[model samples]
Target chain A: MKSVVVNNISKRYGSKKAVTTALRGISFEVDKGELFGIIGPDGAGKTSLFRILTTLLLAEEGTATVDGLDVVKAYKAIRQRVGYMPGRFSLYQDLTVKENLDFFATIFNTSVEENYDLIKDIYSQIEPFKDRKAGKLSGGMKQKLALSCALIHRPSVLFLDEPTTGVDAVSRKEFWEMLRKLKEQQITILVSTPYMDEASLCDKVALIQSGKILSIDTPEGVVRSFGKKIIAVKSSNMLNLLADLKKTELLEDAYPFGEYHHAVLKNESNEHELKNYLQQKGYPFEIKGTDPNIEDCFMALMKN
Target chain B: MRTLKFLLQKEFRQIFRDPSILRIIFIMPVIQLIVLPWAADYEIKNIKLAVIDHDRSDYSRSLTNKITASGYFILTDYTSSFEQTLGEIEHDKADIILEIPASFEKDLVKESESKLFMAVNAINGVKAGLGSSYLRSIIQDYNREVRTEWIQFPRFSPETSIEVTNSNWFNPSMNYKVFMVPGILVLLLTMVGSNLTAINIVKEKEIGTIEQINVTPVKKFHFILGKLIPFWVLGLLVFTIGFGIAWIVYGIYPAGSFLTIYLFAAVYLLAVLGLGLLISTYANNQQQAMLISFFLMMIFVLMGGLYTSIDSMPGWAQAITKANPVSYFIEVIRMVVLKGSGLADIKYQLLTILGFAVLLNGWAVVNYHKRS
Candidate 1:
């Protein structure tokens, strides 16, 4: 059974004349107990889509349901069954860590004892500071507490909007580990992030940009969709290398990727000719064909 | 019911944990209740009198003595030059200048009537009005003394005056504190109940916690109740403290039973808190909530007839007071505290406030949407 089903969902902001289209015919589905991700940059309708699925916002067109319940009509029942952590820190700052968790538990008419086993892995990390106010916690600790609170009710479907946006690198890895552990408990998780690297951690990701989805597939499947050779090239002057590569009619696109510029060659451009042309320009460089990652695919999709 | 209990628990925890809220709850009552009543005394006194005694005669001296002895005028300056006394008025050394013209004794003895010129600095209109009236009454008393001394026994005076003896019932001493304490209590209740609940929900909105709560299974009715009950109880707690202060400090124990006051306060709190929640629904942040609350509270308190009389207000203002919930509570509190009015006497006001409670909370609940 599908945990979430969104069909042709569209939303617009502002008045009639100066309308900003935030979502355009957004449609997707999350299978039961699957870890789903809506991957995009900022203002790519990621938050708007999350809000629509969580029933906090209404779409101008189409329908969405969580756990087989209509987001609009059965919002009350959906609210009871789904846990949503908004993009921003939404817990009471003045409340202590344990108090925050207990408060959310009580709000859902549950007890901490009932859901302790489910959140023990995440909650145990910050359980030592249970008495400290939530606002005083470090960013990672705050995220852990928020996750614990979001999971306190043992929600059937969990929606986390940019859960790791401001977290440190280590904490972001640990948060993903926590999500992977949660997937084992049969709780379907729908998470959003602007970090392209986190896309592979999700069971499946929908690459979205400018209020539209470019593609929805597994990590490797998205890279496979690139379906073109990418030559990673680097020289002493990496700055001019990108500009030089883009100037060539032989390449589809070239962007800086760490120490090397990942250049996708046109179908007609031969790798040997490209290397020869660069050598004749008196620019000594190293070039090699490389595998595309999610970021590369995202960049390629965004270009199209 | 269980959800409401948890909600109240969280709200009260937040309230007690914040030092600023504690200060507002405790410190404000101490300052407003203890200091305001004494400072807001309306009984006009200490009129600075600059006397221009041109006659310098027995009667002028006697009039001056009587005016000074009346305890209303301070007799700031006594001089022969009217120009000098005008300087006294200009310099703010005196409030009223009493010029007794020359031949004052001779004219009064021969013609039995004489005119006296009194000039008052009209700035600070209340003081000027009250000071001049006080001086006028004292002069009239001096004239009565002069006539009684001059007339023989059993002789008919030329003028017959109708004497109006006044009786200030309920508050026989006309103590300003006694009248003010009850009104201040009502104001205290309003400030605590409305301002706290007004900012409570908006604080959640600003912190982004309201979105979390909205996504929960918590019903709108329960959420609003949870926000309201803690503050409502706190409002009544403040009221009790204010009432105790009124009794211990001002010696003002209400003539009516305490139950009547609480019963009215219970309904009054619901109305004001409902108003606060209604404002919270419209406001997106604490600043907006505070600004809107301040605006409505200003209108409510001013027109509620605390500082001024509703009857004295113009027709439009009086019409506003009729709609103002604060006015009803102020009127009800005064009735119960001063007049010993029972629940039956104030049932009309109680019902009107109940109507306000129903309307405002209903409108708030209707406007408060779980999704937008």
Candidate 2:
């Protein structure tokens, strides 16, 4: 069963064409118990789309339904069925973690004791500081508290918007692990993030840029479709090597990737030929064939 | 109902845990309730008198003594010339001037009546009016004393049957403290209730928790009601504490039923909380919420007749008071506390507050955008 369906959603701001067409005709669906990811950079309409699906915002030109209920007409019902953790840590900072959880539970006309099992994994991590004000908690603890609050009512569908954007690497890893545990409970999840690596953990991924969906598929499938022989080159003189590689006769695309330079061949040139050409140009370098990653796929999609 | 109870419990815990906000909520009201009434009095005192007595006779000296002895007027300076006294009055060094005539003693002895020239600054109408009344009363007393002492009896004893009957309905002594304590309590509760809740919700919006709440199954009305319930109870708690303080420290106690007072306070408090929620819906940040709430609170307290009587104000100003929930609350509180009137006497004011509560909360729920 489809847990969520978004069709042709678009949003515009104002004159001076500050008007960013957020979610321009973006359409997608998530099956029950699937961990779906919307991967994009800043201003890619990730938050806007999440807000629309969560019933916090109304899309100018589209229809979205959660649990087969229209997001607009059935917002109240949608609210009951969906759990949302916004990008920012927005729990009551003045209240203790326990108080925040209890308050959220009560708002749903339920009690924390009634929903303890659902939030136990996330809540236990921050239970040591249950009496501490949420504002005084660490970022990771705040994230945990927020997640616990969102899950207190055991909604069938969960929406997490950039949940790990400002968290530490360890916390981010831990958060994704918790999401996996949640997935086992057969709850459909729609998670949005700007981090490309996190895309691989999702069952399916959508690569969005500038409010437009560039590609949507499994992470491995997206990388497989990159269809380019990528080479990583390194030399003592890195800057000159990058400039020289871009000017190379057989080099189709060359950009820095971390500590190495990533390049694609113009017409399927061999490594021996590339090494000989570089030697002739007096640019001593090492070259190695590398498999395309999610970042590489994103770059390839963006370039097209 | 259970949701409201839990939410209210959460709010109370939150408020108590935040030392800064808790301090502001409690300390501010106590200070304002104790100090504001003293600072807001319109009664004038300590007037500086500059007299230019051209007729420096015993009668003139006696009249001057009488003026100085009135306690309201302080004889600051004695001028020889009229110009000097006039300059003193213009410079604000003197409040009033008594000009005794040259034949003042002869006129009083020979003539049945004599007139003394008096000049007073009329810039501040209330002060000027009180000053004139004080001077006239002093002169009248002095004249009566002189007449009785010098002449055994008047040639013609006109049987002037002048009768003066005065009755003060509530607070017979007209103790300003009694009248003020209740009003200040109303003002204090309104300020703390509206400002704290307004800032609380707007802070959530700024921090992004409002979005989190928006996605939950919680109904919008439940969410808003849950948020305001805590502050509403806090307002009542503050009122009760203030009532106790007033009774113990200031010897001011409510003459009406405690239940009536609490009931009216609870209703009025809902209106205040509704106004706060309305403000929070409009404000995007904590700072904006605080500023707007403060502005509205100022207008509410001032127009609510906490400092001045609504009846004494102009018709237009009085008409505007009808829209202010604080005005109704203050009137209800005063009537219940001072006049010992029950719900029947304040039914109109209670209805006005009910209307405000509905109107404000209706606007809040309507204008509150689910998405931004």
Candidate 3:
């Protein structure tokens, strides 16, 4: 069964004449026990979409439901069952870790002793400094405490908006591992991130950009739908190669990536011809076929 | 109810943990209550009197002696020339001039009446009005003394004298401290109740914690009550401390029952805290909340009749005080503390504040949206 279903949701901000649209007819779903990711860059309306689902905001058009209840009509009921951690670290800074945890637990009509099993792994890591104020904790510890607070009630669905936006690599990796453990307990998860690589970690992802969804599929399925040949080209002089590749008629797109430029060709067979044109320009280079990652797919989708 | 309990626990913990808030909540009121009443005194004293006694007769000198002995004047300049005394007033040395006409003792005995021209420098209007009144009462006393002395023996003409005896009731001593302490205590309670709660929710908004609270299962009514109850309790705590200071430092014990004072305070805090929450709902950040609260507080305290009498105010200003919650509290506190007014005596004020409590809190609740 679907845990979350959003259909044709739209939202606008500001006054009448200077209105800025934050979301535009966006639609998607998250299955029960599925880890769903909404991947996009900043200002891509990820936070706005999470706020709509969490009932902190109202959508201008369309409808959303959480756990078989309408988000607009049954917001209070949804609030009980859905856990949301905003993009910002919003736990009471003056409160100790233990106090923050207990506060959330008691407010949800439970105690730390009751739901100790659900958050044991995450809470135990910060339990050593449970008496320390949350503001004094490291970024990774703060994120962990926030997640623990959001899950104190053992919510059926959790919405994390950019949980790893500022976390280090090791912590981000560990956070994903904890989410995997949570998924095992049959909890639906909807996470949004600006990091494209994190998209592959989700069971399914909807790539969004500028208030519009570019694509929605499994990570591998998204890569398979690229339907075009991409080549990685590098030379001693890498800067001029990108500009020169875009000038060529045989290339469909060219952009710099790390030390090499990933070039999309109009025809897969024209690779040899494109190489000859570069060689004629007195440039010695190396070219080979490369698998398009989620970012490359995102670029392809955004361009269209 | 459980959710509200947790909310209060969190709020009280946060309040106790912040040292600055604790100092503001406890120490500020103590200092203000001990210091403000003495400085905000309304009784005018030590008027500078310039006596231009043109008659320098035995009766005139005796009258000047009586005026100087009244303890309200300093007798700054005693010159015969009126122009010289006017110069004394110009230099701010004299606040009033008593010019006794040069009739000698013959005019009063022969005509049975005397005219005295007095000039008062009305620059500081209150001081001038008070100084002249004090002088007039002393002269009246001297006249009654002369009339009674002459009546001790039979005279050629018969005269009737009507004597008016005045007495001040309630505050018999006319003690400035007694009159001012209760009013100041009311103002302190208002400041603490409104200013603290005003910045409370807006602080959460600025720190981004309100979004977390908004997404919780807590209802809006519970959320607002959770915010209000702790501060409401603390506001009353401040009032208790202030009342203690008034008793200990100023020796002001309320003439009415303590129960009546607390009963009014309990309802009054709801109105003030409700106004604060209303401001918090409209303000997006702590800075905006502080600014709006400060602005409204200045208007409320100034027009609340603490420093000035509401009866003497202009018609429009008095109209504004009708809607001002602070004014009603100030009046009620004075009535209970100084005049020993009972609850039945202030039933109108109680119902009016109750109405304000409902209107303001109802408005704040309607504006405080859990989802937007």
Measured against the true structure, the TM-scores of the candidates, in listed sequence, are 0.95, 0.88, 0.87
Q: Write the per-residue lDDT of candidate 2 for residues A176-256, one digit (tens) a residue.
A: 999999999998989999998899999999999998999989999998888878888899899988888888878778889
Place model 3 in a CAPRI quality band.
medium
Q: What pairs collide in candidate 3?
A: none
Error of 2 at B58 (Å): 2.8
lDDT by residue for model 3 (A45-141), tens: 9999999999999999999999999999999899899999999999899999999999988888889999899999999999999999999999999
How much DockQ does model 3 earn?
0.70
Candidate 2 C-alpha lDDT tens digits along B1-372: 665566567667767777898787678767877787787666667877888888899988988988887778899788679988899889998888888888888898888677788899888788788988888888999999888878777676677667799999899988788878888898888887788888888977888877776776656776787788778877888888888878877888889999899988888888888888999988999889988987887788789898878999999999988888888888888888898999899888888888888998899999987665
Tell me how each candidate scores on DockQ against the true complex: 0.88, 0.63, 0.70
Candidates sorted by TM-score, best first:
1, 2, 3
Superposition-based RMSD of candidate 3 using all C-alpha atoms, in angstroms = 4.1
Superposed on all Cα atoms, model 2 deviates from the true structure by an RMSD in Å of: 3.5
In candidate 2, the residue pairs with backbone N, CA or C atoms under 3 Å apart (3 or more residues apart, or in different chains) clash, namely A79-B217
Runs with alpha carbons beyond 4 Å of true place in candidate 2: A13-20, A102-124, A235-253, A268-289, B81-92, B97-125, B143-152, B155-167, B369-372
Top candidate (lDDT) = 1
lDDT of 1 at B176: 74
Worst 10 residues of 3 chain A by lDDT: A267-276
Quote the lDDT for A241 in model 3.
88
**Native contacts recovered, in order, as a fraction for each?**
1.00, 0.93, 0.91
Which residue window of length 10 is worst by lDDT in model 1 chain B?
B152-161
